[model samples]
Target: MIWLVSMYLSSMLFLVLGSVLNLGLSLLCLEKGLSWFIEWEIMSLNSSSIVMTLILDWMSFMFLGFVMFISSMVLFYSGSYMSGDMNVNRFMYLVLAFVLSMAFLIISPNMISILLGWDGLGLVSYVLVIYYQNEKSANAGMLTALSNRIGDVAILLAIAVFSGSGGWNFLFYVDNMPKSDSSWLVCFLIVLAAMTKSAQIPFSAWLPAAMAAPTPVSALVHSSTLVTAGVYLLIRFSPALESSNSRLMLLLLSSLTMFMAGLGANFEYDLKKIIALSTLSQLGVMMSILCLGYSQLAFFHLLAHALFKALLFMCAGSVIHSVKDYQDIRMMGGLVYHMPLTSMCMNLANLALCGTPFLAGFYSKDMILEVAFMSPINLVIFILYALATGLTVCYTMRLVYYTLSGSFNLGNLYSISDESSIMTSPMIFLSVGAIAGGASLSWLIFPCPYMICMSFMFKTLALSVSVIGGAIGYVLNMSAVSYELNSIKLYNETVFSGSMWFMPYLSTRGVSEKFLMLGELYQKVGDNGWSEYYGGQGLYFVLTKSSGYLQVLQDNSMKLYMLSFLLWVIVIFFSMI
Candidate 1:
């Protein structure tokens, strides 16, 4: 216990020191930019004293704050979550590495540092996710690593494009972006890279799937700053957003994704899936806000969301742990009386997440909408995103209802109350932030009454939408109308009357939906091309055929490998000249 406590303290201290150092580094970036080496990742280039390096600025500070705040809170949360686990020390090591890598990634002035940090976070998170080593968890971690690598490839390509243009350092390119068509291409690739890391559309299938990991891992990644990498990238290069259509595309996709994810969360049965989807939705809102030219608002939203979400996630772990790990709301009911304190904490976090007035989430989320409303969006898109927010409230209330507000069916364990201070300390701290964060952002608030009233009016409008929508959903939920469609509905309702599992993926018009929804169509027209050719059958046959052929040619293949090895050695020997 003493060792665990010491570990937690040291980790927190490390995060704090790292954050402070990042600020000085940020100043260096703002001042020197392309010249700053910024703690090299691997190799070094020759440098001159006269070049302006170290160009750290507000953006860097904001990103550093995000990485440290989440990592520190994650440390606190993990202490409680991993209390009795045997491999706690190893877990702590990976978490620390993840934190260190993310910190370095943000403050990195060049591609080398960024890639190193990027890969480091990926590797560490993979280990953390599969910390249990269960078959299910291991597969999920692989997916996370695989998806993250795909994102990294896009980033590397963008770096290649940037480096080709004589901008090897990230700070130089971001602070002084080359206003060219090639830069636009680089920005596009960068956006692709960001979306993959952020789990934005087209590549967002991995997040909900990653719930197989330990809950603390979810709290760290989903609720923390890791998923906000895309937003940070866009904010860090606000100049790039101003220069290309890539920014507009990003905003459009983010809005669409938020609507889908929020609605999808409303339909999900698992507790973790809902939070995961909400994480995606919130990132969408943040990205959209940032794209519309409000970096500070996005930053504040990112901070506020991380705090409240982390608190709620730990509360979730408590609920699951106390009740023997029930994730589906259908199985959990009336937990409020047993775990009163945890319930209250979840309630506060949920309300704040719904952007209720006077909460931290409200201030940041509201500002995003305010900024968004000023920009042009179709009525359909507006109502959809607005409705998505409403759905966010409904599902959250549903979570509260099923988990805490319903009738208790299970036999009692030790009477559930507040968790230990070790657990609740971080949660309480975050809950305080959730409650107080609205007042913290100065740009959005003022001391005047009429203005306050106007703000109330706007909130009232949003609140009205949320309440009414939730009320309708609640009625539908209980009316027996939704009951028929609730069970195994995604595959059936998605397409083919229960054949495909496209629940969260919204259907589009024309050939795209038809091809996706109507696989039978392809079966009729191109059975070999669509089904057997691409669906593991062809690969299996090819592998079988290759194995037999290789068995017959094994002696010859060995000789070829030997010959090739000798030729390579000879080439190297010659090149030595």
Candidate 2:
């Protein structure tokens, strides 16, 4: 308890201090960087002035503010919620690890610090994700760790490519580092990173599994702090995104991730799990906007989302506490009568999430749709995004209707009043923020005037769509219109058998040893496609599942055999030499 208290207090101080320092330093840096950027463009790459300016403009105060806000909120919420749990101290330590890591992530001037923070976060989150240490939680943590490591390799390559020629830093807006020759490789690697972190497509399986952690952990991880790490990467490398060869595929991936995940959230019955899936979808939407060159909107939505979604998850936790362990909304009907305060908070949050006008969701999401329309991608993508907006409304309405409105039907389960002030207060605070979050509020370093106008226009569009969509959704939930889009279920059926198409040759070793030699060796082979006889999927799958059988000799004889083989290979090399 002492360690936990000390950690929380230290973290709180860090957050308070960091927010102040970031505001002053980052804003000053951005202005300096911007001025230098203009001069660099005029003076050309040969001038030494480029290096001077590179130091100033490489980061943003607004982004730092985000990092601080998210880290602080996660810490505060975790401290309060996990107080009585057995592993409270351990959880607090992990929370500190994340805060330290995430702080490093935003301020990281070059790729090295970025990679360090990224790796640290991946490691710590793995521990936190499996905090319960049960079979299912362990499996989820392993999967998250595996996916994170896979993405980490791509970042490592990006660092290598940048160091080789791009002067080890982005001195200008368009510092074409990997050069046009390696554009494909760079794009491919970045896309891989985004896929893993943002929970896009095939890599998305790990996110749903992450819900095995505590609710507060889930609130922090799923809402913004970790899941949106990919978006942070995208924003950081916005300059590089333009250089990718597979622009169309990357764009499609983003849009598809957004629309498809929205559908999945609808099908999910568990309140928190639904929010988790929705988090994945919203991130995809943000990426799609970023890919379309809409930075302001993306940043705004990231903030708006943090406000509402985190609140929703926290409120869900409250409901669970009140009921003593029910997650599925099907098991929780008509709670509005029982827990009126909780119900009101959820309703407000759901309204915002559904993108209704005058709400935070409307403002950020509208801009995404607006910017996406300007891109030359398929019109079908826009239609898909629009339909997702509808689905977002429908599903959120379902949540609101089932959990809060209509009846107080826990099906004869004894009703309980709003129990704890600790839990309900956060929801109330967040609800207030959700209602007024985008209402002409000025951020310290961000252009308040520009943001306010942009937010208004975006909110108008979002509100219009959400209300219309919500009406239709309400009809469907009430059996007024019975249509299940089933888009979420589509990917499962299609990717079922064909998923084994991408198997990668791991090393020069025989089929047996090829499966060993750690993670790096495997990533290398994945990058270089060996479409030959042995490296193909069918045979590799058979070899890997049976890898346990190959351990054979536990004696020193095995070591002697390896030593002899090495000596023989060396002698052959000398003879050749």
Candidate 3:
């Protein structure tokens, strides 16, 4: 117990120290407009160098600082959340490994080095997801791992493509690389990889499924470490993507992802899954804006979202811990009366998610929507941005109505309270960030605010949508014993929207159903039927029968030996004659 406690304390301390150091370095780099590359040559083959490289810049340093800060808080939170588990030490180690993986990804610009971190994040996250060791966790872990493997394969392909350029360092190549088919292909692969990591559109099922993980791991994975890795990677690759047509596709897909996630969250009842879907929605906002060539805006949103999302998850964890492991928001009501502090933090986080004025989300999310409005985009993209933004608030309001308002529905014997100081401390710390992170990041990332000349109608459109969405969300969720079952009335639409447009089904069963059936047929016909006669089992039977005949011959060896001798003698006499 002491050892575990010490491990947690040390990790939190180390991460906090790293966070402070990186923040200072980021400020220094930003002030001087400086970047440094430290490269060590691993080998050289045919004029192409295989080198391990670390990149230090304002962007990398600031992102690293955020990652470390969140990691520290998560570690501190975990010390209480998993305090009773026998495998707390293992969990701590996995979380540390996860943080280390993100660190590697944040600092490396080389494809090879990035893959090391990228793959590490995927592998470590799988372990963390399955930390609970249940059927759901196992399935979720598998889905998460396989979905991310798509990105790993893409990075490998990019590396193979980059080999033609005589170097694997993408930092030096993203610009000034002559426009060519190879360059286009590399950009496409990079986008594909980023999509898989960020859980955009078709690749998005795993993010919600991964809520099967422990809440602390969810806080880490959903916030700064895993999900944002793709967005961060894209922010780095935005320069190259600018010239490629893939950015347009990314914009459309991310917009759809945002809309789908927000719609799904409205229908979701699971508290953790609701939050996970919101994370997905926020990720879409980042990706879409990045694709629109506002990488700084995307980066700013990423940092602000990280702070609140982590706080949100911690608050969710505290609530779950008190609620006897019940996660359905329908079962939670008037939680503010039972756990005031957690309820406050959750409300703060949700408000941030909704882009409430002056909050962290407002600083970045509102700006992204405005910038998107000003950009020359199709009507479809514009409507998507608008509806998705509204849906974000709608679901957030719905969640609050279900979990924080109304009457408590649990049995009288159940007692729920926020007594865990360790858990609430992190929540309190991140609440500060959730309130100020956006404005602070806005100032740091943009030396001067973005100036956009737009009509008044366009300026208020985002706010109008948000207000309408929130009102409808709260009013719709107000339930009574006499009320009609609207969800039942619109069953198909409910299922379609609630299931993320059946993306989880498509990603898992729809994709593998035919292949699984094929394998079953092969097992019956090949392994059990025809192959039994010609394959390994058949060979085994034939060898057994041959051995039996040899045994019979040996048993009758004396009589058989005499007959053979007589035949040999007769043959010898005929040859002599």
Expressed as tens digits, the lDDT of each residue in 274-379 for candidate 2 is 8876787788788888777666567678778877887788878878777767887767777877888987888777777877678878766665676565567677
Off by over 4 Å in 3: 479-483, 516-577
In model 3, the clashing pairs are: none
The local distance difference test score of model 1 is 0.71
TM accuracy, model 2 = 0.75
Q: What Cα-based lDDT does every candidate model obtain?
A: 0.71, 0.68, 0.91
User: What are the TM-scores, per candidate, against the unseen true structure?
Assistant: 0.77, 0.75, 0.90
- The prediction achieving the highest lDDT against the true structure is 3
Between the candidate structures 2 and 3, which one is better when assessed by TM-score? 3
Model 1: per-residue lDDT, tens digit, 2-102? 98889987897778677667656555554464232334234334431212223345555646765676677778777877888898888888777877777
Candidate 1: deviation at residue 110, Å?
2.1
User: Which scores greater on lDDT, model 2 or model 3?
Assistant: 3
Per lDDT, what order, best first? 3, 1, 2
